[model samples]
Target: MIIGLYFWNLLRNQQSNKTAVDRESKKEMEKLRKLRSIQLTQPLAEKTRPQSMKDIIGQKEGLKALKAALCGPNPQHVLIYGPPGVGKTAAARVVLEQAKQHASSPFLQDAKFVEIDATTARFDERGIADPLIGSVHDPIYQGAGALGVAGVPQPKQGAVTKAHGGVLFIDEIGELHPVQMNKLLKVLEDRKVFLESSYYHEEDTNIPRYIHDIFQNGLPADFRLVGATTRTPDEIPPAIRSRCMEIYFKPLLPDEIAEIAQSAIAKLGMPESPEAVRVVVNYASNGREAVNMIQLAAGLAITEGRDRLRAEDIEWVVNSSQISPRPQKKVPKEQKIGYINGLAVHGPNIGTLLEIEVTSMSAEKPGAGKLTITGAVDEEEMGGGARTLRRKSMARSSVENVCTVLRQIGLNPFHYDIHLNFPGGVPIDGPSAGIAIACAITSSIRRVPVHPRLAMTGEVSIHGRVKPVGGVVAKVEAALQAGVEKVLIPRDNWQEMFAGLQGIEVIPVDTVEEVICHAFPEWAESISERGESEGNWIDPSIEPAVQPILPFMQARSTSE
Candidate 1:
């Protein structure tokens, strides 16, 4: 009976241990279930990102071109050029989805979008591993799997491999390192990424067929690349740029910013005052910035227990966030002496209305007048005055060119001390501001006022000719936004067609003389007098055949 009881006790112990194991397994699964139930909070920008192409704002033309490329039977690789926070990545993703619906498109239903920022991408130079292309994880690596640990090589798929038959979107592609970029270019040409490693042996008995296949035949990376960069076309490498179709996204206008703000507010199920919306638009330059400002304002309002966003809330948010208002210097209603409005473009799309002002005083010594320029820093030297002057070589050269033209036109630049200033201390880099600087100096020296409503952009030659400048369309748009009534561009830019220039008049002039005629009409009588006596000058507005010059004796006799 004791022997039977011993066996029974052992059986009872085994049963209890089994029951405990079952209970532990159930508890672990319950914990996992609880963890799975937890939800992640998404930012307002991501939550409000457009899922459909039609929902995207402020880039209708770009979207149309993108759609054509993505939805066509033979889709091409693309490069999206634009400023930050302008929906390049989001647009790329949505276009992929839309392409899947088109029967003619090559994209499959399961086509994926694998995105990476080149700014943060890590690459292995030895070809051991690459995050963009597939990498070979050798047996020595810690997580190379049990098979790999047992002296078999393993191939790890990367973004390029995973995005096969779909899109691989690289943000800030211009920031990519040259080595990695070369590897990517190779993949682009071959449509496959080859894996290589000393640890990988084809004849190994333990090697998986898939691993062997990957090592022998490169992994498929036949995916379309959609690269987004904030850089201009010139900044991008020629090889990559040549392979892709480029699309540019313009900077958001004030009205577009306002509309984006309203949409974001509605998505948050929050009410915002119209004035508050306007305030956000005034502070933000792009749709992304506008949405972020609105979200910040909404958060402040929510914390205060206010149901609707107030202008005061926006103001508080702006102050707390340190968001500066858009630089919109009020357009002078009346002409001002020595001050002229000049237009400048920052990048592909951003344009600013710059105010160039000139003031002159009699020099301490006759014929020893000096030209001092401010508001531009020397790029070569980072320190003070002389360096600053050197940094503004373009501006200085422009001033010298203007002086040459003045000397040619019978004005002595050395008779007075000339001080040129670009207000707000903004660096003047390009030659596009040449004509405006000349106009400002002439107005200051001649005691004439330049029309405040007029803004001009063109390069001024030493011969008083106005040379054509790039970004004329952008400059004119900026002038219109700044409430300027008229813009004077080079005659060569007259062929450039610009949309939304209804209220503003854009006059094309080939010479500084023509610009002065339009800008300083009050001095028209003086200009006519000078032109008549100076055989070199001709007023383009008059017929050349009608104005006959008389010989010295004949003219003298007629005057008597």
Candidate 2:
């Protein structure tokens, strides 16, 4: 009976142990289930990054150029120039995948993309370490593993080596060091990276075959390079730029920003108001920023127990983010003498409207028509001194050119002490303001009010010709946003203006004469007659050389 009891006790113990094991297994599985339920959420920008080229916005031509280069049988190095947040990196990655799908493409199915920022890359000029090219780990270094203790040198692969038979995308290529750049150029030329080490002996059989090959035959670095930067061509290295196919990515337009925000909101399955979208576009400069703002607004809305994003939420986020709202330049309600709107492009595609004003008085002495230009670099507190001296000189030259144009139009600039002012004391640097300055001066001299609804941008020549200037599209967009009714652009820039511009009329002017006709239509007949008469009106026999003998003479002349 005791034996039978012992046997039953052993059986019971085994059954109990089996029950415990089952319970432990269940608990472990429950823990795993809980862990699996936890998921890390991705930022809106990353979650919404374009997975395919078709999803990219506002860069159709850029994408086409990239595809042509990547899909060809022989891929060439590419350099992409653009402002930040315009999908330079994303496009590079997607295009590679797209190329792999094409039968004629050089890319293989397993091609990899390695990305790094040139701003963060570090290189040793002593040839000791390089993150881009391969580096040798000497036995004396820490964490050398078994190879270091055994007095064998170890070769470490870098981004260039890992990206072999694929692509290496470097962001902010302009910031790379010159020494590192030269090394990269050498790698590009040879499609391999050579490693050197004092401890590495070719006679050592303990060395791995791969390490031996790298030291002897070099590491395989046959990969295409794609570089992106916010700098212009002049800022990039001539050697590097000369070897690459250049592609320019334009800044995202306001409409494009709105579209990107709308798509992001749709992807999030969140409701958003139209006004909210408009607010986001006004505050955001690019697609990435736009999506970020929407995400923040959506989060705020969720906290408030609301499903739809509101304009107030966006405004709060914008204010909290410290993003300055777009400057609103109010168009004057009434026509005023000597005041005109001049357009200027601040950056890549941001346009600002500057208000220019002019007033003239009788000179203290005959033939002493001094021109004092305010709001340019020459004037203190306008903050343009930071610009290059050449830019400042150009601004002054534009003023002189305007004075010359005035004199050519029968205005006795030598008799009047003309004071030119840019309202708000904002610096005016570009020559594009030449036509506006001339118009302001002419209006002041003729005592005729210029239309407040008119905004003009062009460089006026001494011969009264209006020369074409850059940023016509940006300037016109700024005018339309500022409630300006008409924008006068150079006739040569007619092809450069944006198509389907709404709510504002763009008038193309060929000469300063046409500008005056549009700016002062009421005096167009007199101005036309004076322009035709030319030297006859300015003849010494008919009129005084200095007509402004005093304030009284000026008043009488104006009354006449």
Per-residue lDDT tens digits for candidate 1, residues 271-347, read 65798888888898888888888888888888888879888878888898898887766578887889999998877
- For model 2, residues 96-174, the per-residue Cα lDDT tens digits are 9988999987789999999989998998765567888879888888888998888888888889999999999999999
RMSD of candidates 1 onward, in order: 6.4, 9.3
Q: lDDT of candidate 2?
A: 0.83
Poorest stretch of ten by lDDT in candidate 2: 548-557
RMSD of 1: 6.4
Highest-lDDT candidate: 2
User: Cα lDDT for residue 11, model 1?
Assistant: 100
